[model samples]
Target: MTSTEAPLRYTAFTSDPEGGNPAGVVLDASGLDDAAMRAIAAGLGYSETAFVTRRDEAARRFRVRYFSPLAEVAFCGHATIALSVALAERLGAGDLLLDTSVGEIPVATGRDGSGAVVATLTSVPAHSRPAGRDELAATLSALRWRAADLDPALPPHVAFGGNDHLVLAAASRERLADLAYDFDALAAVMREHGWTTVNLVWRESPERFHARNPFPVGGVVEDPATGAAAAALGGYLRALGLVVRPTTIAIRQGEDMGRPSDLLLDVSPADDRVRVTGRAVPIAQAGA
Candidate 1:
């Protein structure tokens, strides 16, 4: 509590402590430099950790930074949710405006029907473009997946929320479940294209889907729940006219990994921004 020592750990996108992506939260990182934050994030070994550099209690505004094990990231969705839930526990549920490297993100925290704190984040302007032939081929090769394995309906696209993500839809659930890929090759492709994660998904229904994210760039083999990618997906779907009308989709991630996270996305053609909602829970310290 004194100038941010060890970070407070929390899991996002799920109610269970053990069933979501875990992130470290440094509530007051006022004095810590970049090196210190990077070192703390690397030591914790999470996909991403959030540091609150400045806070305006009266305004409910905060400036934050995110770091993965390898380096600082522009933005991170799960960490944002985790941090918001953590703050809500202390400040009570309401609205918060976060100043991040990408842009200002508006987040609202409230209790769900079960009385569990849930955080909903509105992403910045979102958009997407079709992945080029060479880019698609390289990504498919790196994933060891053939072009035939892709779903024709969801063409390959590079989508953006706060960050960029490669969205690929699998033809079947089996293809989505089998996720072994060449780490070095995929990482190279991602770096070349500036993709944060490869969002591999399978459509179960009009409003439900399963997703898995390969995040080699962040030095993680996989991400259980990715909020930024989810927002990007909403943009992708809407931009491509996949969702003809306003609707909400349920994205089930990390089920294969046994973490089992749930993310809800509200997408409307009238607006470009995506609303992603999820619940976060604090992780008890070891032997606490």
Candidate 2:
């Protein structure tokens, strides 16, 4: 395909039109500059757009960049899924190395028994640290949530995979369902701390969880399916010893917003990183 051909875009993490997160895809963005890429992403108006440029044919790696409508992001999972599916269409399913600005991300793609492509990304090394007392207080105040509403077992902390996220476990499912917050107020705190999203979660069972993410830093009210945050949560769970070793956990998100998404997380005892897997279907062409 020539540069004049239209870009290939796809939504990730859901098979339905209105479910999952939408991402813009440009299979070849070799000639596009930063401004041009940003303009395209802004024009597309998705949460994020993935731009790929050839870097090495022998290694099957490409230099990738992610842009939000408002600004560039270090990494975006939905976009990565979309790009991987798109590439699989041409090169067939296998593993591809994505050289992102943050780090090198390895994505493995394969087809299900029904022949639908699925992509699983192994995130960068995961780590978590306790949130400062003042920061936690400020975050709660901005969200209008009292300290007592927080789950004492899980404490407030900043978790990092490819990006940084603040993990807050609510005391109850009721608290997790209530999603009223000061957008700008929380945005200010996130900006100050360079956080990507506030990962609010409620544990439904030992292996199941419900989560919501407020993504003020990305200029979005909330993210429907956050793969990066899922990786962080896996790290947090492992750190807290909530789950046994070599177990798979399920996370249900975006239900409150009506775009229900399911994320499967694989945690291993030997590694600190987490592997997140999900299915992504292409949005209709008319909508694209």
Candidate 3:
């Protein structure tokens, strides 16, 4: 492709044009610099974008970078899914290694029973720690959520997979549904703590959850689908001994906002990492 040809990209996690988190996919970005990449991602105006440059075709490993419209991100799950499918279309489906800025992510791709290409990525290690009372209170204040709305059982904490996320479990679905926060206040707190997103979740069942992610650091109000936070939630559940290992949990996100998305996470007893899987569809190019 020539430089004049706008980068060939796609969005993942939603089949419909209007649904899911939109991601920019550049299957080949060998010649692009950081400025060029950031510009491209900004031009696309997606939440996050993936730039892939093959490092070793034989090994099926590629160096990847993630960028939001405004800046670079440590890792992005939906973009990873989109890149894997884009690669599969050209290189055939199987396993591929993505050497990201955070760490190496192993992704497996295959056609499901319905013939849709499904991709699963194993996150870098997972861990969670207590969120100080002061921090939690400050976050709640920024979110305009009262302490009574918090779930006592789940509590508040910071979880990490590839990046750090502050997790807040709501006492009711209604509380989680009404999301309005001081964007600048939350962004300040998140920046000070090096947090990528504030993962707000409400447990619907033992195996099901409703989630919303406030990504102020990325200059977005909310992320429709967040894979990294999903992995972190899996780790949080395991750390709290809330769920059985080797079990899968379904996360229903973006529904309240109208762009519904499904994220499946697999947790295992033997390892601390979590696996997130989903289907990604390419967004058709808009007529210029």
Candidate 4:
């Protein structure tokens, strides 16, 4: 295999190699250009892959880029977690500052209760806006969902946390589970709106939620786990005053996909940046 093809593979948001969102990590991608990175990510067939273009060991800072199979992604949360754990295993756990397309993201890595390395990423300033009626109608049409399927409490909104995500809350867990959508239609709508993903979620309780993301814009039908979307959800709740106080939410995703990924989100009424934490495990060559 060529140097560009030999990226380290890891699955984020889960400790098991077989679960979570798998991402390709190129530790030293300084030599690779945009085309090379895109090609690598395309061949790997992951939702997104992370490339560390430049690293400053002294300051623990790096310039990173993310690419999906079809295009460059502005930011990717799962890939960030995957890369952070990979770095910690080799360089030792610590704080890392990543300069991304959107803005700088701060990540902290340390051992969890299970003695497994977990990474928490503080997203860039997050905000949300109500989705226009026309836009919401178009998106719902693409997803084959009707107005009745939506949760009245959580209105449709376009949220930003490094990238733009359309947050749609389902009225029931059953509605969230039955995901059948037009890929081409959804891709066209997402591209037109410059949306990174459609965050479809069902709130099980005050602090727990189940989610699924349709990433047609990335050439992926569905993402097992999406950290960017999770962060966006937090921002959406805060912006709408849904979160009255500081809260930590547990997001269960990828269960329907059989990947079973978990994401922890911390959000506060006063804080604009949301914190997402998850564990990652390396995927062996044979498994990859």
TM per candidate comes to 0.98, 0.95, 0.96, 0.97
Q: If both were scored by lDDT, which would come out higher, candidate 1 or candidate 4?
A: 1
Tens-digit lDDT track of model 1 for 49-161: 99999999889999999999998999999999999999998899999999999999999999988888999999999999999999999999999999999999889999999
Better of 1 and 2 by TM-score: 1
- Which stretches of candidate 1 lie above 4 Å from their native place? none
Question: Model 3, range 129-181, lDDT digits (tens) per residue?
Answer: 88998889889999999999999999788999899999999999999999999
Clashes per model (N, Cα, C within 3 A): 0, 0, 0, 0
**Sliding window of 10 residues with minimal summed lDDT for model 4:** 1-10
- Sort by TM-score, best first: 1, 4, 3, 2
**What are the runs in model 4 whose C-alpha is more than 4 Å off?**
1-5
Q: Which candidate wins on TM-score?
A: 1
Give lDDT: candidate 4, residue 33: 88
The per-prediction CA RMSD against the true structure, in angstroms, equals 0.8, 1.6, 1.4, 1.6
User: Model 2, range 94-146, lDDT digits (tens) per residue?
Assistant: 99999998888999999999898888999898888999998899899989999
Alpha-carbon deviation at 220 in model 4, angstroms: 0.3
**Which lDDT value does model 2 have at 85?**
83
Give a tens-digit lDDT track for model 4, residues 1-288.
234458999999998888999999999898898999999999999999999999997898989999999999999999999999988888889998999998999999999788899999999999999999999999999999999999999999999988999999999999999999999999999999999999999999989999999999999999999999999999998999988899999999999989999999999999999999999998988644
Ranking by lDDT: 1, 4, 3, 2
Instruction: Score residue 161 of candidate 1 by CA lDDT.
Output: 93
Candidates 3 and 4, the one with greater lDDT: 4
Best by lDDT: 1
